[model samples]
Structure formats: C-alpha cells, structure tokens
Target chain A: MSDVTAGALESYLTGRLAADVSVSDLHEHVEGWSRDTVSFTARWNEEGEQRERRLVVRAESDAQIEGDSAAEGNDVETEFRTMAAAEDTSVPVPETYWYEGDRSVLGGRFFVVGHLPGDAPVVWDREQRQDLYRAWDEREANEGDGKADGRAKGGSENDGGSLPSQFVDAAAGIHTLDAEDVSALADCPPDAVVERELDRWVGRYRASTVRPEPAVEECIRWFRSNPPEIPETTLVHGDFRIGNILVNEGELTGVLDWELARIGDPLYDLGYASTYYFAGKLIEPIERPELACSLLDREWFYDEYERRSGRVVDRERVRYWRAFSAFVMMTIGLAGVHRFRTGETDDVRAAWFQYIVPGLIEDMLAIVREDRL
Target chain B: MPYLEPAAVLRRFSRFALEEIRPAIDGEERFVRGQVGSMASTLRFLAGELDASERAVTTQENALHEALDGVEHTLDDHDAAATAVREALADARDTLDGTDDEAGSRIRGTRERETTLLEACDDVLARVEANLDDETARAVRRPLYDFLDARLDAQLRTLGRRNESGDGSP
Candidate 1:
C-alpha cells in the first residue's frame, strides 16, 4: 500500500545502476503477508554497455511484525542480513542487492534482490501435488545409478531430482551452517533453546487476545512441564515449508521468506515442516496426510535429512516440536485474529485467519494427546 | 427485520463484491484485487457464522460448567492426593464464584464467564502438572480435554466453513 510507483522505482534504480533506468512490468506479489514484494524488470546502460535485470523490492509492511506486539528478529534489516549471510551457503537464496534505509524512496525501509525465475507452488493444489508425485516417481525410478537428475531422462537441465530431495538438501544446507554465520539472528544457548522458544511463543499467544484460548493455555502448561531434549542448535528456518520456497521444474530455485529465520534447534524446522496442518490435512482430508508439506514422506524426509546433515534424528524431540510448532501456528492465527479484531490492520486476510484457529488448536491437541498417550 | 435478513444482505453484498466488483478492479492492481477477493470471502464467512455464533457461545458456556463440575468432583475424589492439587481446585472454585457477574447481557455474560473459567483451567493445569502422578494427571486432564474439544467444536461450527477455493488453507 505504500507509494510504490514506477517513476519512483526508476529514479531509485537510476541512482543504483549508475544510468537512466527504465522500470517496467512492476508486478506486486500479493501472496505473502509478511512483506510487500514488487518485482519489475529494469533496463539501463552501465559502463558503455546496455544492461537489463529482473529484480524484486521487498519493503516492510505497515503492519507490525507478524502482527504480534512481542515479536522480535523479524524486521526488514534482519531479513536482508540473513539472506546476505546465506550467500555462500548451499541454500539457494536470491542475490541481495542494495538495502535502502530511507523510507522516502520506497515509503519504507526496503531491500532489492535478483529475481530468480520460479514459482512458489501452492501446496494444497491437487495438480501441484500430482506434479510433485510425478517428480518424486521420476527420482525413485532413477535411484540406482547415482545420477538422479531428471534431465538425463529427457528433462531440462534445471529439472534436477524431485523437489523433495532438493527441499531436504536445502534444509540440510541451512542447518549445517554455523550459527556464527547469521550473528544477527537471535542467539540462544543450546540448552536454553527449547525453553526460550516455548516462552517466547507462549508469551506472544498470551499477549494476543481475541478470545480465550484454553487449549493453548493447557498446551503451554504441558509443554513447560515436559521439556524436550535439545540435540544441537543451528540456524533454524523458523517457517520452513514448501510454500515459502521456489521450485522450477522440480528443482529449488530460491529459498524465499527469510523474515522468520533464526538460530534455534535445527529439528524445529523439520517438525514445523512436517506438521499435517501444512500438508492440508486440517483443511480437508487429503489422500497423502503422511506427506510433509504435501511433498515428501515424513520418515523418508527424516532419514534423508539425517544422512545429509549427519545429525541423529530424534523422533521424540521431533514429536515435541511437532506439537509445539502447531501451537506456534495457532498462536500466529490468534495474533492475526487479534489484529483484525482490534482494527490494527484492514487486511481482510487477517480477518479470514480466524477460520484456521480452531483447526490449528485441534492439530496441537491431537499431537499433544498422542505424545501423552 | 427487513425483507432480507442480515445474513442474506451480507451474502448478497459478498456475491456482488466477488463476482462483480473484484473482476472490475484493474488486474494490474493485484494487491487491491486480492484485497477485494479477501473482502468477499470474509464477508461470506461472517454471514454464514452470524446466526450460529450465539448458539456456539451458549454451547461453550454449558460445556464450561460441565467441565468445572467435573474438575470439582475429581478434586473431591482425590482428597487423599497432594495438598497443592486440592488447593488448586479450591482456588479455581473460589475464583469462579468471586468473578461471577450476571449483570451483563447474555453474550457478555458468556464471554466473561468463559474468560474466568479458562483462567481457572490454566491455574488448575499448572498445579496439576507439578503435583499429580501420571495416572492422576491424565484423569484430571481428561475432562479438561473434553472441554477443549467442545470449545473447538463450537468455534469450528461457528466459523469453520471455507469457500471452494480454500483461499486460506494452511
């Protein structure tokens, strides 16, 4: 909603590109709520040569970070820094360009990145799931010869192995990165990761109030009482899931949405991604409820992640995080509902978030009950 | 009280917004168009839930009372249990009694009562985890879980239906 005009973008890019830039095809990506993303193609002359590039501008939203008052480490600067920190890692991140701190240029602090060509597939779409099934089937068929690239079998060069393998490899790449790399992320002692995360999220839930959520309260008490064992702490992509990453012909293009990235338990991402809620089980019962993110089998994902990352997969710890992650999702839904109720933001999507609250609570309860029983 | 009920009015407006207004918006203004679409969806959901909200709240109130009674009974049955557990039950009962306010309207009364009962549940749960054994804690949490289930059912019945597009799924 900020004043993002083509003229302003041209003026800004003219200064950055050191030439008269003509910006066109300004398209706003409205799918993500965390930031205002607009992608455009810029043409300019540099060093006596004509140049053109597809770039994206991600600006801070007017709404509070994640719509929660107590949320931290989700600012625009943090996101830019996190992406910059991951530049050398195996995780595919968009090449970060200049970060503008002045709001007069973009109406908010913003950063520009190279726009990679890919689509962030909707996980719940049946056609998309069918495509993923084919991709995985293709990989499984070529499992023996150590050359699993789909391109060898008459596919395009970018059509590497299935999205699931690339997904796990990218996650392993993130988890294997040293915590010191992303020094700007909230750092917690290895032993304190579970408690700190639990308190932080629970506090956010308690702070957000559209109505009383006794289920969350009960979960808070139970999780607090029974703490999970902390295996190893690494940079956890706090919101890791298929929908946040881009895929081109069954290969990962770029890992988008770094706002929620932080340093915490690596298993947290596995648990968060493995939640059936994201697999579309909570919305409507899908056929593959066991699939994580509607793309990969849960146990297979765990095995692959273990083999790739060389970290032991603890089912119990993953179980704890699964329940906790659902609780986290419920809390986020509550926060959105709270924002809408309080008229903090007029985004009707926030109002629609209420529909997911009950289902999320149910998911959390189901996970917790399974653990206890 | 008019010819068309409130829900009908809302649904008509929602349909107009979705089918007529949204398409009329410039496709280049994708964010605005998306907002219009979300507006239609929210209005549609609100229209559907308008009538069911009161019933859902009433069901929740009744379930809350039942859960409170069950917790009280469990506490009494476990008189030989830990002192802190007994005290937790007693404090919950006292809080419910002290916070009872029948001076408000039905909806307000339900909301306030629900809040008080939830707070009591939180207190009892916190204490129970610290004081009770595995079996005793499970027995105590069973009724609370039932209460949670009823609460979830009421909420879902009230605001659960999504459009065919599943716009906000996950």
Candidate 2:
C-alpha cells in the first residue's frame, strides 16, 4: 500500500541478503490494524547451495494513535529493540534479523525478522475465538489446569489451543527481565518512570486531540496529584494481552507489537490489559469461560501476576495505573476520531472507539475514586 | 409514495448480513460482518432510545447548571481562563435557553447549538485543569468534572445499560 512491492523488496534484499538473493512468495498482510506487514520468502545462494529464508517485514507507518507517539502501536523501532532485548530471555519473541530506520531503504523504514509460524488470533473474529476457546476448554477439562503462566508448550492443529497459564507466564517472563540487562531498554531516572510515562501519553494527547476532553483532563490532574508509589521498574509490555500474543498448537509463541513496550511500572501493563478490557467480557462471559478463565478473572489475574513474577503488587499502584491506562486509551480514541473526521482513514471503528470513551471514564473514576458514579 | 421505516431498513440489512454477507465472506471480512451486525443492533437500540435520549440530555444539562451554581460545590475563584470559557458557554446556553418568541428567529435558530456550549465547556475545563496549580485546579475543576461524569452516567442510563461489545480488536 505504501509503494511496497515484491520487486522493490527483492531489490532491497538482493543487496542486503547476499550477492544474488531473490525475494518471492510475497504477499501484503491483510489482518493488522497499525503496521503494513509484508511476509515473503528470500532465497539466497550460500556455498553454491540455495537456502530460503522466511521473513516478515514490519514497515514503518504513522502511529495508529497519532496523538500518542508513546503508544505501543505503529512504531517499528520499539518492536525491533524490544525483540532484540528479549532474544535470550524467558520471553518468547520472534528472532529479529535486521532492522533499518532509514526510510530510503524501502521507500520507508522497515525491519525484517525471522517469521515465527503461528497465528496471532484477532479477538473480534468470534468464530476463530470460539474454536480456540473450545480447544482450551477441552484441555482444561482433561488437564484440570488453571496454573498462571503455564510454560508447557503443547497444542494440536485442530484445537489451536493454548493454556492461560502459559500467557501469564509470558507476561511474567517479561516482568522477570532485569531492566538494566537490556541495553536496548533505556533506564528511567530512579522513581520517575511513572511520571515520565504520564508525560508521554499526556503529551501525545495534547498533540492530537480534535476536541477538548475534560474527563481526560481531570484524570490527568488526578494522576499528577496522586502519584502511585513505584518500588521498581521492569519491562512493561504496554499492550500485554491475548490479542498481541501468538499461539501455535496450544504453545505460547512470541509476543508481537512491542511499539508500546517501555521501562515503567510493570503493574501498568497488568492493569492496562485487564481494565481496558475484561470488565465487559466478565459481565457476559459470552459462554466462553474456558477461554476467559485461561486468560483469567480480575482477582485471578492479579494473584497470578504476583505469584509468577514474585513481585508484590500494591492495589493502589494498580488503581492509579488503571486510571492512566484508561486515559491513554481514551486519548487514542480522540486521535482516532480526529484522523477519521480529517479523513486519514475510513474505518468507522475509529468512531466506535470514541463512543466507549464515556464508559471508560466511568471505569477510570471507579478505579481512582473507588467511588463509582 | 411510501418510504421504508428506518428501523425496518436496519433490520433488513441486519438479516442480509446474517443470511448473505456473513456466509459469503471469510477472514477479516466475515468478522467485520459480525461487527456490522452488532452495530446494526446497537443502532436499532439507539433509535428506540432517541426520544428518551433528548429528555435525558435536558435533565442532565439542567442538573449540571444547578450543580455549577450550587453553593456547597462553588469554586472559590473563577480562575480567569476557566471563567472565559464558562462565560462563553453560558452565553451559548442562554441563547438556546431563550423561548422562541422572546428571541429573534435567527438567534433562536442559529446563534449557537446546545452541544456547542457543552463542547465549549469541556474545552474550557480541559485548558483550566492543565494550567492551574493542583490545589486551585482541583477546586476550580471539580464541579465541571462531576458534571461531565454525571452527564456521562445519565447518558449511559438512557441507553439502558447494554454492555456494548466494544472494538473487539485491540
């Protein structure tokens, strides 16, 4: 879509890969919301023998939440650096092969990584989700398992099932990383991580809002007035949830979309994934407790995080971050509405995000005030 | 001449999505069809609530005005920037509040829409909170914040507490 063609990719890779590398089997991905994803086969001659490399290239695109540059969506560099850091860690990440920020390389900046074979299921796709959940149900029925962050890598083709414990384990895996060890992750000044994060989304909000949002403004003031006590900074996967996770044959695969991953309160990610969603899902359960339970209930998710990460989670800290997460999400909606009204994209879903801003405000108030409106 | 009722059209389209569109598509397209179905239902729901919605808005706005002027919750100072915005909104609101006979047709019809005042209020409050000191900001902004939150709560109430299946994708 961005003048990215097979021939152009081949030309770029031919020089980058080897003397005579041929790019073929190229197809532009149709599923992602943010990045223009391209998956192709690159063949190269090494020692007079032909070798094929399966690669997925993440093309640099404008931020999905244009208002929030700090948002975890649509940035390629964050994903590349984060993946590089997680290369040898307990966190399962796709091997990043080569990254280039120079736009001149492929008409825009893009990064190539070894393609991990697994499907990162879209949550909106109810049919596929039902199938996956059914698989989870069968597994849970037989195994009697709901252990948090189950590390067991096992699944079958039909079931396309995975353990909820495994997903939590993956989150725990990222939380377990020593922030200092990952050279790619920058260190926040001691105890200023959350404030720095607040500045990030707040700046992004001010940059892209189409209209003034008093609810968000109030939430911002509240966060500033009531800073959560941060004991430590760990790798925060800004959007750590089932949607960004890849699953294959019930095995926990690599985490995708590291654009929002940052160094901050690790609990922020936990509250973010659960509070931003699950509140409604928990209400309906939609007849998929098997899948929902695997991911978890509210209390279960909190307990699991503490149990697996071996980190004490202060409820107030979570409450504060939950409010911030809601603010970040609301601003993203504002940006989306701006883009749509300005005709940046035609998706009505952008407007859909704005509609939920009211409910999310209620959610934030519930967390921050502990007094429901 | 006869025209199809809007609700009927939505239901017709909803049926088409179920019988023709959803079955005919696959991949993201099929999932989107389901979303279309969800949206169709919500729109139908909204259409049903439209009469009640207008009343709900009036009720909420009246409460907000009462709250804005309530003695117990009053701001210590107008805090200039916030005052400008609130004064402007008050003007807009007064224009809309006038009886049709009491004001010229042009003023009654087109001086400023009611939602415009509401948006201006939000804009003013947004600016006020960002710039003022935390103590002064909290005091100046609380009534407006409470009003907006209550307005949202009332708005949701009109919609009948239906938990919308929001953007299914992250």
Winning candidate number (TM-score): 1
Tell me the tens digit of each residue's lDDT in model 1 across A178-217: 5788887877878898788877888788778666666777
- Cα lDDT of model 1 by residue, B1-170, tens digit: 57879988898999999999999998787878988887897788788677776677567656766776786677667664567866877777676555443544333555666676677777777777787877777777777778788877666656654423221233
What is the per-residue lDDT of model 2 for residues A195-299, given as tens digits with 9 covering 90 to 100?
A: 787787788778767654556666676788788778888778887777777778767677887877777788887777666343233112244331332245546
How many collisions between residues are there in candidate 1? 0
Tell me the TM-score of candidate 1's A chain.
Answer: 0.92
Reference-based TM-score, model 2: 0.74
TM-scores, all models, native as reference? 0.87, 0.74
* lDDT score, candidate 1: 0.77
* Candidate 1 TM-score on chain B: 0.72
> Scored by CA lDDT, what does every candidate get?
0.77, 0.62
Which regions of candidate 2 deviate over 4 angstroms? A62-75, A125-162, A276-294, A371-373, B1-56, B65-150, B153-170
